[model samples]
Each structure stands twice: as structure tokens, then as C-alpha cells.
Target chain A: MPEMTYAQAIDHALGQAMAEDPRIVVFGEDVVMLRRELYVRFGPRRVRQTPISEAAFLAMGVGAAMAGLRPVVEIMMVDFIAVAFDALLNQATKIRAFSGGKWNVPLVVRTSCGGGYGDGGQHEQCLWGLISSMPGVSVAVPSNPQDAASLMISCLQSEDPVVFMEHKLLSDYWRDYLGGGSRKTVAFDVPENGRIGKVEIPVKPFPPGKGKVVRKGEDLTMFSLGVGVHRCLEAAERLEEKGIQAEVVDLRWASPLDRELITSSAERTGRVLVVDEDYSAYGLSGEIAAVLAENGLRPAFGRLGTEGVIPYDVRREAKVLPNAARIEQAALTLASV
Target chain B: MRMSAETVPVEELYRQMCRAREFEMALARLWEKGLISGEMHLGIGEEAVAAGVVAHLREGDAICLDHRSTPPLVARGVDLEALVLEMLGDPEGLCCGWGGHMHLFSREHLACSSGIVGSSAPLGLGFALASQYLETGGVAVAFFGEGAMNQGMLLESLNLAAAWRLPLVLVCKDNRWAITTRSRTVTAGNLARRARSLGVPARRVDGTRVDRVWRAARWAVERARRGRGPSFLLAHCPRREGHFLGDPMLRVYRDPLGQVLEIAPPLLRSLLARPLSRLASRVRCLGQIGATLGALGLELLLEADPLERSGRLLEPSMRARVEEEARREVEEKVMRAMERRVSRA
Candidate 1:
């Protein structure tokens, strides 16, 4: 085990995967230099650089995938994918279905997502929702370094196309694992069916279909994902001393919603609050609310999310995202009611 | 193959144009009958370029065609029935009914065609890059119209291909019309000159003559395969029909036939007199069709009844089975194609 930043973990996984399989090639704009310097001390053959043509480079990745290569191609920013959409949506997505499951495109397109860089609209966007909606593509947005490593490795092993969504915000966040005596890194074997490791944090047994309760509570169930999970936990701790217990659930994976945990928690408290950074309409929280309603479970409190697109203003974005104070307030109001 | 060669018979070239013309007419009828769903962008007058360029390609060489490259695609060995099936949204189509006629690719034929303009050039470079990076001795040809010359992405591809010295042949069929816009109106100067400025040797040829295009394509493809770099072949031709099947283009551009009649009356008169020699023309057309079918080692659908149940070669049950079974078949074909490509390494 080793202490690794979120960005370092990504480098470890890419380095490990490429070493394990020669067929695996990594390429993107400045990825070769950045990954090599920041994370892995590897050669150019494994981590290749590409020209600024996103469409061409992406299609090259697609061609490489079709040619039996496990390619982890990076799109420097999530927004840039719109330029290479023809290759992504038209070519890579449909290769398997169009070929009737005959071809397996083991392609992992890694890119930095989310806001926090103050890079404006062009550089910051959580396109995970849009990408997850596309068929024949598996979207994974890891909240921390451990999940990033786990997901990147899993993406390389999967037969289908995977969008390994690495957020720019959590890149420098620190975490630890015991070092494997590996100052001089060597290739490690990968499991046939990729591995996904969960971090316990202040919670436990973080599994799909089951959300961990960060703080045991009976007042309200605070459901959130990614960075929102951390905020909800902070809010829950603050509300605990005020005699309002808010159970916090961190949804590690978004697509395969943890309905059982959500419904049971809603049933226990009779009140639920869903918080997300994206806009309220057509957001993940709306879908979760719809699911609970469909399952005959309604909470006293509803979704807390931005009404529209996140404004470029840093202050506005922070206000739009449900914070610890907002979550605590929402939970206490539901408890009193 | 010479830098200039007149290998195709002018009469045969005219017949190929007529085939494209008649095929488009059939497509129009099919659309009206509600058999075809999507907008059909036909390649009526661009028969010579397709015939010439495709005639130069070997079995393993690949081509990336644009929306209006139907004539070239057909010339490259895609079945008319399959193409029509695609237009009809049948499962037996090229993309298993997933991508109507607009997005068509056949691994067996080693060609990929798409509907998006300016995008195919980059994809073509990808195939060429794949060949070079993987060390496959194959050339990738991008068949684009003059209209695509102004596209930024295509220009980017030109720069990339030039920089990397990739094995790519960028064929620009200058028919002078992109949808409704004239090439002269959009392009700054000669398209060949544009390619030449990119530091690659380019030539302009008479696209009406299949042989000239073939000769030029041969030289370009050879240079690319040898890793000398990319070259552009600008085939100068004329539009003989509307931009697409439904486009009433006569309302826009002045009909060239009227102008040709005024300037080159004897040449126009000779072309007009061609139909009067009907019996000889019919025999020659039949012979050519026979030769083409023979070359492909396939029997003419007209010659033998390949089925016992009906006038069609395929029985209704079999056709239904083909439609039902096509999804799996396409998948298997793509997988096999991928595997075969991998084995080549």
C-alpha cells in the first residue's frame, strides 16, 4: 500500500495496466509528459502524446481499439469530447452493437471533469450524466484517488467502452495505502474481470445498491454523490449536536442507483433529501426522486440542487451547490415538521 | 499506372454515368413509394471519379467515402440490394439497419463511408495512421468532394498527414457543386494548388475519363504505401444531375447542357446521336454487364432463378430469415474483421 494523491493513483493504475498488457497504449494531449512526470516514470511508447485534433486522436484510439489494443486515451477536458463526438458516439459506441456483439472495444477514455479550477464553462463540466445516457458506454466518476485507481484498472479490463471520469477538483486530494516497496515501479498482473475497491471513510461497506450511513440518524436521509457526499456528511455531523440525526449516504456509482438503501432509509425517517451540484431539472436527484416516488416511497423533504446551469461566478456556484449549512438546515426543518 | 492514362472507354464511362442516373431515378421512385426513409444524396454525375479511383484500388486497400460518394461505394463492391435494403431500413443492410444509408462500412470490402461532411477526412487519416503505426502495407483513400476542401478539420488532417508522412490518398472530386454552392464560389483557388501548398505533390485530371483518375490514384496510393507521405488527386469534372434525388437543382445553377450545346455543338450532337444506335449499344451494355459479373465470380441476378418459390432469387422466408439473422451476421463479420486485422500484425 502507498500514500497517493488522486492524480498519482490514476498514474499508478495507468502504469500498472500498460505494464501488464503491451496492447494497452496511453495517448492524449500532454498526457505523456504530465503522467510521466507527476505519477509514473515510464517510457514514451506506453504513454504517447497526440496532436490537438480531438476528433482525429479519438478516432485513432477507436481504430486502435478495433485493432485489438486496450487503449486508455485521454481527452484533456470533458468539454472537448463534443469535438470528437463522431468517433465517440458514432464509431466507438456502436462498434459492438452494429457488429452484433462480435467486436469488443476495450477502450477507456479518461478525462478531467467538474468545476473548481475556475476554468470557466469551456474547461469545466460534469458530462458524466450525458455520457452515461449513451448506450454501450460505461461511465465511472470516482470521488477519490482509490476509486480512480480501481476504476481505471477496471476500465482497462472491461470488454466494453468505459469513460473513466477523473474530476479536476480531487486531483491533489491526499490519501494513503501501505507502500509495496515500489520506488522502482514494476508491472503487476490484472484480474480477468476488473477490480473495484471501496474506501470506508467515516462510513463502511460502500457497495452498489447499498449506501453507507455516515452518521446514524432517524430524522432525515441525506443522499448525495461525489463531492456532495462529503458536504452532506459535514452537515450531518453539525446537525447531530442539535438533536437532529441526519443519515448521510454517499452514492459512489451513479447509474446503478442504490434503490434498496435509499428506499429503506426513506422508510425509516419518513423524510429524505437529495443534493447534487448539477441543475434540478433533468439532474440525477430528479431521477432519484422519480424512482422513490415510483416505488411508493415519498419523503417529507425533497431534492436540493441548482435550478439551472451553474453560473461561472465562483460564489454563485458555491451557493448553488448544497453546502453543509444548507443540508443541516434542510434536515432540521424536516425533523421539526 | 502512368501519371496520365486513358484506360477507360468513353462509351463505357457514359454507361456507368447512366447506371448512376438510372439508379438515382429508382431511388426517387422508392422514396415516393415510402420504401426509403432518409434524405437521399445521390451521386449522379460523379460516376467517372468513382469508377476511376475505385478501379485503381487493390483488394485490401481501404476507402473512406463522404455522403455523396455512393457511386464510388457501389463501384467498390457493395451490393445494390444491400444498399437498397439500407435505404429501406431493413436489418440486412450494411450497418444492420442501425445506420441508414448515410453511415455505411464494410470490413469485408475494406471501405468505410459516413454521412458527416469534413469529418471523414480525419477518420481516413486514422485508418492510415493505424496502417503506419501498426506497420500494415495498406493505403487509406479519402474520397471527398471539392466542398470539403474548405473544412477546418480536413485542413487539420492534411497538416497532420503531411507531418507524419502517413499513407493516405486524399482524392478531391471537383464537380463544382456542394449541395447548391459552386466550388469556385467557395474555394479560394485551384484545389490541387491547395494540396501542393501543403507540401505534397498534387495533380488535376479529367474526371470524366475513368483511366486518367485511376492512373493518378495509382501514383498517389503507391507513394503513400511506401511511406513517402500523402498526396492529393483533384479530379475536375461536371455535374450532370441535381445535387440529390429530391433537389430540383435546375432552379439554381444554369443547366450546363444548354451551354455545352452552344459552345461544343458537334460534341453535343455526337452524344445526342448515341441513343439512335440502340441495338449496338444494347449488345455492348449486356456484354459489359456479363464481363463485370464474371469478373466478380457472381452470376447475374437476371440469368438464373436462384430460388424455387418466387421470381426473386431469395425466398420470402429466406429473406425474412436474412433480415432476422442479419444482426448476428454483421456482428460476426465485424468481429472476424477485427480478428483478421489483428492477425495481420
Candidate 2:
């Protein structure tokens, strides 16, 4: 079995996809550096670099997709997608729908998101809620390296536009914080003729809109995605020490939410806690709570996420964004209720 | 295919312009009758720019249009009946009624339009980039107004097209007004200068003169096809109508009913013209009468077959037959589409 970091997994997935399909082209600011080896391998034609023109390039991706090629546009930071909102929301998301399904935008906007290094309000934001709110586009948020690779492949293969979010915290730079570089790599079963060789590490097939219960228990179900999934697992472990058996469901994709999985989990546990890295109000947490309520499931619900402002300081962000301590406390409170 | 100014066809250009004009006038009439809902930005006076530039494009070439998009779509050879049905929110519209007049798209025609300003530039750049990547020899044309000159995205698109040497042509319809505010008041420097600053070749043409526009577009399209990067065209023209139909200013300047009455038979014109003026000022009773008369007159004009009305442009004997054939073809297509909608419903 081969061990690969989260960044490596994404690179591998992109390389494999490009190798299989000549139509796929990747372009973004600084993508040449992020995927330097792929650039060298694919050359300037397939893997191109663009000037700092997010709106133009992003819309270009939409145009390219409509014309005939599949384009993977990388927005260096998720928050910067705001600049390309017209392209993403108005153009890419609505093109197929607006065109009466006459045009399909096979575009994948892969962006790195999340707050941990105090990268202020402008740089760090888990905007899955915002992107998922759009009807036409699919939103994919992967928790681990294996899911990242699989989901990236899925996004590339999708006929419609997809926003693939990568949390900065899951990158190799924070490997030390994730347990002193001792992170376990899970590899998925690759197809026989897959471009990349089969590895020993286990891989999970991240089908769009399906979630997995990472740690199952009966006391309560903690719903989270991306980096929050890891935090929820840690919180569940802490709860286990205190005789509380918490179940953590990693919601891989946020848009076509795993309603049945959440509903069954909520019904069995009767207590739901949604810990999100995005804002609490009008975000994924509220959405999950609404889903449970709408399904006529009266579970004891508690939500924890960033409240109002995303702070620039690392300490404040840690306090604002959901951590294991907060998730544990929120879960315990929900269980008591 | 490189087209020189001498090779630009006048008859075809005239036909395209007439189609755009008649289509828009029909839509305006529909609006007046309360058959169409929502905003419609008609390109009544800007038909030349659309006809001229679109004539230079082939089937594979792409075009992205702005809100005042009807002219270009019509010029690009989109199904006329489909366009009207789309505007009417019919299910068989080009966009299946999902997108109204502003958001019309026809992949078969390689044409798309959106309500958002400054969007066409980037979108067109994408099409051009695809052409460059695929080596398809197709050029993408972006049609915008002077109002979009300041948009960061438009400027960025210009820069990118130049940087990558993508086959793109940016045609700016400088109608001197961006929805009532004179464009010059908000815009600084020259419109073409903005593109030239980004290392893109640019030219300004008289948008009202179809010949001039055709020649300029032909030159730009040739440059792009030859892989010389993007070219910016500033089309200076007039907005003969208000931003939308039923604009008070439009009526003040050019009243359809008034024009019809002016061109009416001698006795009817004299009698109606004098009384209509007296009645128009009475403010109460006469105002209502004037409104009814205007509506009635416009309806009568719409009923008078477009073929008969097109006699002004075509040879009187040949005009009626040609118009009848054209109208029947369009009507039959529209009827089939409507029947399909009914069957589906």
C-alpha cells in the first residue's frame, strides 16, 4: 500500500483524469506552482496559467465548457470566489438551466477553503453553504485524502458544473497539527486500467450526495463535512471516554445532502448535533436542523459553527470555528436535553 | 474566410436588418397588447451593427450578446419563431421558456445572450480559448455596449485574450447612453483606447451605417482568424428607442400611431391628425380617446400583413409575394411549436 498526502491525492487525481481525457484543461493563478509536476508533464497547452483575473478566467472556464472542452478552474482561495460570483452563480450555475438544458457547463471550480492559519476574513471561508444554495451547481466537500481523490474524479466526470472545496487544514502543511505527521492514508480500489497504479492504502468511493458514518454509536449523531468531520471524530472519541457513544457522519457533499442517512441517524439517536466550519446562521448547520425538523423527526438538536465574524487572529478563529472541545460540549448539552 | 469591404453583400445585410427591425417591432406590439411580460431591451436602431458583424461569422463561430440581444440573435440566423416564443415565455422557446428575452441561448446557432452587463466579454474569451485549444479556427465575438467599458471583468477579458492571443473580437455598441445616463458622463478617455492599452488592436466605426460596420468587423474577424489576438470595435450609434418598450420618451420622440396617421390616406390623415392633436391636449376625456385611438391604430398596423408593409423596402410587386412566403414560413413554424407546447401540457 502506498501512502499519499491530501495534496498528493488531488494531484494524482488530476493527473489521472487528464491522462485519460485530453479535453480536460486546468488553469488558475499559481496553479502552475501548486501542480508543478503536472504542468511539466502536460506542458503549457493542457495545464495553463492565467493572470490574476478570476472573473475572466472563471467565466472562460464556463465558456470553454459550453464550447466543447472540460475546464478545471482553480480559484486559489475559496473566499476569492466572491470576485467571480457573476461567472459562477450567474453564468456557470444557470447556463444549462437558463439555456433550457441546451448547454451543459462541464466545469469544476476547485478552490482551497477554511480558516486555521489566521488568514483573515478575505482569504479563509468555507463557503460550501453559499455554493450549495445555488440550484444548478453541485457542491462537493471531501473530508479525507481518499474522498478528495474520488470526489475530484467524480466532479471531473459530471456533466454539470461542480464546486469542489478543499479545506486548507487538510493539506500537508498542517500534517503536524493533524497528529505530528502520523496521519493514516486510505486508498480506494482503482479500476484495472486506471492511469495511476493500484496502491495498498484503502480508498472510499465518494459518490455525490452520499455521506458515511465514520464512527457509529447510539447516543447522538454529529453531522459535519470537510475539516469539521475530523474535529467531530475527535470530539466523539473524547465523548467516548465519558461514557457517551457519539456517531460522526462525514457529509462528503453538501448540496444533494444525504437526507436518508441523516434522517435514519437522527431517528435512531433522537439527538442531533451539526458542527460546521461555515457560519451558523443560514448555513449548513441550520440546513441540517431544518432537514430533521422537516422530516418530522423531533430530535434534541444543537448546532455549533462560526457565529458572526471570521476573525483574523489564529486564537480567535480557533474559538470562533468549531473545535473538538466545542463539539463535545454541544453534543453533551444535546444529549442532556 | 477573409472578407474584404468590396465583398460585403448589401442585399443580405438589408434582409438581416429588416428581420431584426420587424422582429423587434412585433415584440413591441406584443408588449403593447399585454401579451408579453418582463423587461425587453429592443435593439431597434442598432440593427446595422448586429447585421454587419454577424455577417462575417461562420456557423462554428460563437457570439455572446447583452440584454439588447435580439438583433444579434436574429442576425446569427436563430429560428425567428423560437426567439418570439421564448420572449413570450412559451415552452417551445429557444430556452424552453426558462430564460426570457435577455437570457436567450441557441447552441446550434452558436449564440448566447445574458442580462448581466460585461459578462459577454469573458464568456466570448472562453469560446475563443476553446477554439485556440481545439485548433478549430472559430472566432468568438462579444457584443456589449459602451456601458460595459468600465467593468473589471471586461477589461480582464481583454487582457487575457491579448495575453493568450485567443481569437476574439469585442464589439462595443457605443450608443452614447447606458440606460438614460449618457455613457460619456461616466466613461473617461476613449473606449477603443482601453483595449489598445491592453495591447489589443481597436477601431471605431459608424454603427448606423451597416457597410462601415461590416467592413470593420470583417477586418477584425480576419485578424482573429489569423491568430493575431483580439480586436476591439467601438460602434458609435444611436438608441432610437428608449431602454425598453413603452418608454415615455420613446413615444415623445417617435409615436408609432402618429407615424401611421401621418402616412395614412389624405382625407383620413387630415381629419384624424387635426382632431387627434386637439383631443391629445384636452387632458381628461380626450386623453382616454387618444389612448384608445393609438392602441387601435397600432393594432390595425400590426394586422396589415408585414409583407404588404415591407413594400417600402422591396419592389412593390415582388415585396408582397416574398413577404407572404417569409411570414407563412415563420407562422407555420411558430404554430407547430405552439401545438407541441399544447400537446405537452
Candidate 3:
């Protein structure tokens, strides 16, 4: 078994999918910079560069999908998708449904989301709520390199449109921030050479709309996705040290939510803590709470997420985004309730 | 300059225009009767543009229409019954009632329409790019109004289509109005020149003249099919009717009754005749009677007789027969769909 970084895992998945399917084409602003090797390997036709026209290129992806070609379009930041909201919200998401399921828009919009590196308000946002709230589109928020690879593959294979979200801080540049030094590695079953090391991440068959219980416990169930999952895991470890055992569930996809897994977990634990990096108001955290309530699960519920507008300063951002300490605190409060 | 009828089939063009005109007139009647709900943007006078441009498109070719989508859908061979059912919120609609008049779509016809302004351009570009990649020799046509020229997305789509040399044709129906605001008030410079600056071949045509629109669209579509790139066409036509039926502003149209009389023949107008004495008896209030008389007069004059006129241009008996058949088909289908909805309930 070898270890791979999150960035490398995404690149590996894209390369493999593009190689296997001739219909796949990747295009976006500065995608060549991120996946240059794939560009050289697949040539310009498959891996192309696009202008800064988010609306046009994103819609081109939708049109391309309607024309029987699979397109993987990348928007540099999640916030920028707002510029192309007409295309993403009105066109890509509703094409199939509007066409009465006769038209399948098989496209993936890969965007970098979340904050921690002081990227400021415009660049850093976890808008999973916006995408997941809309029907006819699926959203994937991978927590680790292994999940990232499998989730990307699942998104590529889906018959509908998908918004695949990647957290900026979880990429290769944030390995140190992940508390993993240069030699640190996470072991997996599959072995492949990544930019950092032999890319070995346990290739699990994690289907879309499914949740994975990373840790099992009876005291409380913590639900998180994307980079917040890492924070939840660390918080769970810290909680164990204080004699509190917390179960952590990684919700991979937001839409077609894993209701069974989440409800069963809450039933077993009798308490729920939702940790999210997005804004607390009308966001993923509230959505999870609503889902739990709608399912008639009356567990003691608490939520930990950013309060308002994200700040640019590092110290302020740390307070705005959910951290391990905050998660633990929220969990303790829910347990007490 | 007057367009040559030899350039395209004038009779077929007339028939297509009549189809669009009659469909919209039917929609207006339905809307007036409170059967069809929601907003409807009628393309009563802009029929030539849709009929002409769609005449040159192949089955594999795609089209994205804007809010005033009835003309294009009718011209693109969409089933009138399905379209009406969709507008009526029937479950057996083209989109199973999820998408209304504005968001109607059909993959089989490779046609879609959006209520959002300036959305069709980018979506059409996508279709063109896919056709280019598949080497399918299909061109994507985007139908918008003069109002959409300023939209950043539409401009971006123009740039992208030109940059990639995608087989795209952008048709701007310059009706001079964008929902009451004159387009010229907001638009600066020339729209055709704007596309030309983006490296696309663009031309303006007389939108009322189907022959002229057909020539312009043919040149653009051929250029795209030959892999030359995108083309922009500005079809300068008239709105002819209000932005929507029953629009209060249309009361200001000069000789509105006279214009309506021109479209509806004397026979149909007589068929809708009602005694003023009976009308007064039904209405107790003078103001209500006045409003009722005005509405009835307009309804009698706007009875979609232009379709009969256009059909008579080819063969009067054949046209009447076709319309009768279509009326029966629409009525039967609508009844069946309504029954299904009731049973499900």
C-alpha cells in the first residue's frame, strides 16, 4: 500500500476516467496549470483551456452533455459559480427535468470551496446548500484523498449533472496544515505514484448519496463533510481523551442525502452534532438539522459552523470556520442536553 | 430590398408562420378563458423569424429559444397539443408539467426554451460545441430578442463561439421592445457590429419578410456547417401585439380594432357575434357592460383567422381540413390529459 495526497488523488481519477472514456473533456480557467500532465497526455482536444467566461463555458458543458459528450468543467472557486448562476442553476440543473428526463446532462463542475488560508470572502465559500437544494443535480464533498478519488469517479459516471466540491486547504499545499509532515502518509489498498509519493488510498466502492461511518460509538454522532470531516475526526479523538466517545459520519454527497445512515446513527447515539464550514444560516448545518427533524429523529441536536461573513485575517477565519475545539465543544453541549 | 420568393418556399414559410400565429392566438384565447395560467410572451408579429430560420435547420440541429418561445416551438415541429397541455399544467405535458411554457424542452427535437433572458446564447453554444466535437454537422441556433444583446453571458457566448469556431447561429429578434422599454434606449452601437468585433460574421435582415430572414439564416447556417464559425443575425421585426395578451398598454395601439379585424376574417368575426341587448342584460353596472363589450369586440376580432388566410394562399379546402383535424386532435388530447389528472387526484 502507498500513500497519496488529495490533489494527486483527484488528478489520478480524472486521468483514469479520461483515458477510459473518449467522450470526456476537461476545460476551465487555469485547469491546465493544475492538470498539465493530463493535458499533455490526452492532448488539447480532451484537456482544453477555456476563457474566463464562466457562464459560457459552464453552459457549453451542459450543451456538450446534451450532445452526447461528457464534459468536466472546472470553476476556479465556488464563489465564482455565482457569476454563472444562470447556467448552473437554470440550465445545467434543470435541463434533464425540464426535458422530462429525456435529456441527461452528464457533466461535472469541479470547484474549490471552503476557507482557512485567508482567501477572503469572495474566494472562500461552502455553497453546498445552494447546489443541493436544487433538484436534478448531485453534489459531492469528499473528505479525504481516497474518498475524493472514488467520489470523482462516481460523479463522472453519473447520468445527471454533478457539482464536485474540493476544499482548498485539503489539497497538496495544505499537507502541513493537515498536520502531516513531508514524510506523513495515509495508507490505502491501491498503489500508484502521485506527485508526493506512491499514491495508495484504500479504493472503497463508496456509491453516491451514501454516508460512511468513519468511527463507531454510542455516545454521540457527528455529521460532517468536506474538510470539516477532518476537523470532526480530530475532535472525536480529543473527545475520547476526555472519556467521551463520538461516532463520526462523513456525508459524501449532499443531495439524495444518506437519510437511512444518518437516522440510524442518530437513533443509536441519541445525540447529533452537525459540523459545517459554511455559514450557519440557511446552510448545510441547518439543512442537516431540518432533515433530522423531518425524519422524526428527536435526538439532542447542535450545530457548529461559521456564523456570518468569513473574515480575511487568519485568526478571524479560524474563529469563523469550524475547528476541532468548536466541534468538541458543540458535541459536549449536545451530550449534556 | 424585397426578398425573392424563389430563394425559399414561400408557401411553406407562410404555413409555418400561420402555425406559429394560430398557436399563439389559441394560447391567448385560452389565457383569456382562464384555462392557461402563468405568464405568456406572444410572438404574434415575430413569426417570420422563427419560421424562416427553422426552415433551414436539420433534425439533428438544436435551437434554444427565449421567453417568447411559442413561435419557435411551433416552427420547430413541436406538437401543439403537448405544448398546450404543458401550459395548462397537465401531467402528460412535454415536461410532465414541471416545465411550463417558458421552460419547455424536447430532446427528440433538440429544442429548449428558457424564461431567463440571455440564457439561450450560452446554451446554444454548448450544443454547437458538442456538435463540433461529435462531427455531427449539426448547427445550434439561439433565438433571443434585442433586449438580450447587453447581457454579459450572451456576449461571453458570442466570444466563445467565435474563439472555438463552433457551429452556432445567434438570431436576435429585434422587436425594438424589451418588455415595454425600447431596446435602443439601453443598447449602444450596432448589435451586428458587436458580434463582428468578436470575430463572428453578422448581418441584419428584415424580420417581417420571411424570405429575407431565410437568406440570412441560410448563409449563417451554411457558414457554421462548413466550419467557418458562428454568425449573428439581427432580425428587425415588429411586436405586432402587446408583450402579453390583455396588456393594458396595448389599449394605446392606434386602430387596435382595425388591426384585429385584418387578422380575423368577416366569417369568424360574425361567428363570434353577440347581441348588445343581451350583453347589457347580463351586466348590471354600466362600467362592467362597457368593459365586457370592449373585451368581446377584441375577442371577436382576434379569432386566429390569419391561419385560415395563410392556408388559403396554398389551398383553401386543404387548409380548413387540416385546421379542423388539428382542433379535434387538440381537444381530444386535452380532455384525456385532464381526465388522467382528475383520476390521479
- Candidate 3 lDDT, tens digit per residue, B1-345? 445655578677776786677677777766555455434568887787888899998879999998789888888888776787676656666766556666778989999887657889999999999999999999999999887786688998999999999999999988766543445544689999999999988999978777778888889999999999999999877665655554433542445675345323422322232322233322223232234335434644563333333344456666666556555655565556556656765
Q: For residues B198-287, write the lDDT of model 1, one tens digit per residue.
A: 876898887765556656777888898789989988886655444443332331224346433432432223223322434444344334
DockQ of each: 0.01, 0.01, 0.01
TM-score of chain A of 1: 0.81
Interface alpha-carbon RMSD, every candidate: 28.8, 29.4, 29.5
* Candidate 1 wrong stretches, greater than 4 Å: A37-42, A173-215, B1-345
Identify the CAPRI category of the predicted complex in candidate 2.
incorrect
Q: For model 3, state the Cα shift of residue B101 in Å.
A: 46
Global lDDT of each model?
A: 0.62, 0.74, 0.74
The candidates score, on chain A by TM-score, as follows 0.81, 0.91, 0.91
Model 1 chain B is weakest, by summed lDDT over 10 consecutive residues, at B302-311
- The deviation in Å at residue B98 for candidate 1 is 42
Spell out the clash pairs found in candidate 2. Answer: A1-A200, A186-A202, A187-A201, A187-A202, A187-A203, A188-A202, A188-A203
Residue-wise lDDT of candidate 2 within A80-176, one digit each (tens)? 6887898988998888888888889999999988866443454567888988888888888877777788888889988999999887767653222
